[model samples]
Target: MISTKIPFVIFKSFFNGSIRIKLDWESLISEQVTINMSFFEELENPSSWYLPWYLNDVDEEVSYLAPNARQLTLADIPKAINHLNSKRRDKIQELLSRFINSTQPVQLVIATYALPDGKHLIMDGNHRSSALILAGVKARLMVFEMFGPLDPELLPDLRLWKD
Candidate 1:
């Protein structure tokens, strides 16, 4: 489940009256992608959604969506944020602040799996996994989930990209 969060937009245009479309969330991240961080950042701006370099050339493997069972949200800091300091502290704080100030819901990605005992395990989305701690989100996640653990023998060959 590829849940990349940002501001959610709800409005109407002459093309579609009374329509609702959630602007792709630009702050929340569930899966990892190799695109340049700047490229992703540009997508957050309404004007950048159509740029050719935005989402440019994504790997097919990165397209998998995670199920909600194999994920969990810990109250502690997200692993990605624990290392923040002067360089990115303000940016992170600003992103979160803007999100809270917006009138939209937060987005997240979760990886889940079922157990023989009938319990679910969420392997990801610690920042906001539980409802009690859920940010202003209507849907808890939007994931690009991958299947069972990879078997090296069944993996595909790698190829280099060319400009």
Candidate 2:
């Protein structure tokens, strides 16, 4: 677990709706492997935007609540590729195989955004996360990028770019 010894009152405010989130920006930069959720979405589906930075930018001032550091195994996470087409699935599988053969550690990127329901939404890295699951690896390091105050009701309207 990645514990910074955050106070209980902070957690309380986060869930009580007083605070939007509890994000650690330091970790994201130090890791140098964060997936920009906003950018990923903009790339997947072109949308009208005022600026290029807006394409991938996340608001730093917005606070969010996320777990200290989760030491998760395969059973801990949901299947990341359920929504993907066969072609994408296969490509991911190939990558997974390569990963298995390599000496490098399997570090997965996870983007955590606050949902109105108070649960963190796991975005991106489905393929890599799923690969970790399939390999039956326990305790992989998952880097998190946090966003939100997003309405849970809007979840239905949201979809990952799979094309």
Candidate 3:
């Protein structure tokens, strides 16, 4: 839950300015209450990276995208939940409990970056990252840290960290 200060974020619209919303900076965004993706699994584009300061190298960036944020379509959350990664399925199931336990609004960061194909990328708020595709949540054009032109094919996958 957020108690410190209101933060800014970024958003990439699939239809309107809502689809994939993201946060900026690592500390501003809380650790995922749950992680649905396995170290070896492939994920949808529009992933996330966090840091104390904006860093261009993937090795220096922190945080990974959450599974709940990767739903392909935004028509229904119920349907998307079913497709969440299998390894951390139990962890994600606990999100509802977290919501029930607290009434405070959880803090999220919005990040905007440029992908290799010239498409813009939004990083942050895994919960709402796909909300636009799932629940049609509206956004206020959140602020973000923008990363210019990154190579999707060159970016490292989660497995790359398995030293």
Candidate maximizing TM-score: 2
**Top-lDDT candidate index:** 2
Error of 2 at 23 (Å): 17
Give candidate 1 misplaced runs (Cα > 4 Å).
Answer: 1-74, 78-85, 108-139, 150-163
Which lDDT value does model 1 have at 152?
Answer: 22
lDDT of each: 0.26, 0.36, 0.32
Stronger candidate by TM-score (1 vs 3)? 3
Best of the two (2, 3) by lDDT: 2
- lDDT for each residue of candidate 1 in 1-163, tens digit (9 for 90 to 100): 2333322121111112211111112321232312110111111212111100111122111211212111112332233243324344354455556556656555554332222222322333322343213233333344322222122221111011101
Per-model root-mean-square deviation over C-alphas: 16.6, 15.9, 14.8
Q: How many residue pairs clash in each candidate?
A: 36, 7, 16
Write down the lDDT that model 2 would get: 0.36
- What TM-score quantifies how close candidate 1 is to the native fold? 0.28
User: After best superposition, candidate 2 residue 79: deviation in angstroms?
Assistant: 8.7
User: Which residue pairs overlap in candidate 2's backbone?
Assistant: 2-69, 21-63, 21-64, 21-65, 22-64, 22-65, 39-56
Residue 141 miss distance in model 1 (angstroms): 1.8
Please provide TM-scores, in order, for all candidate models, with all chains considered together: 0.28, 0.40, 0.33
Error of 3 at 126 (Å): 2.8
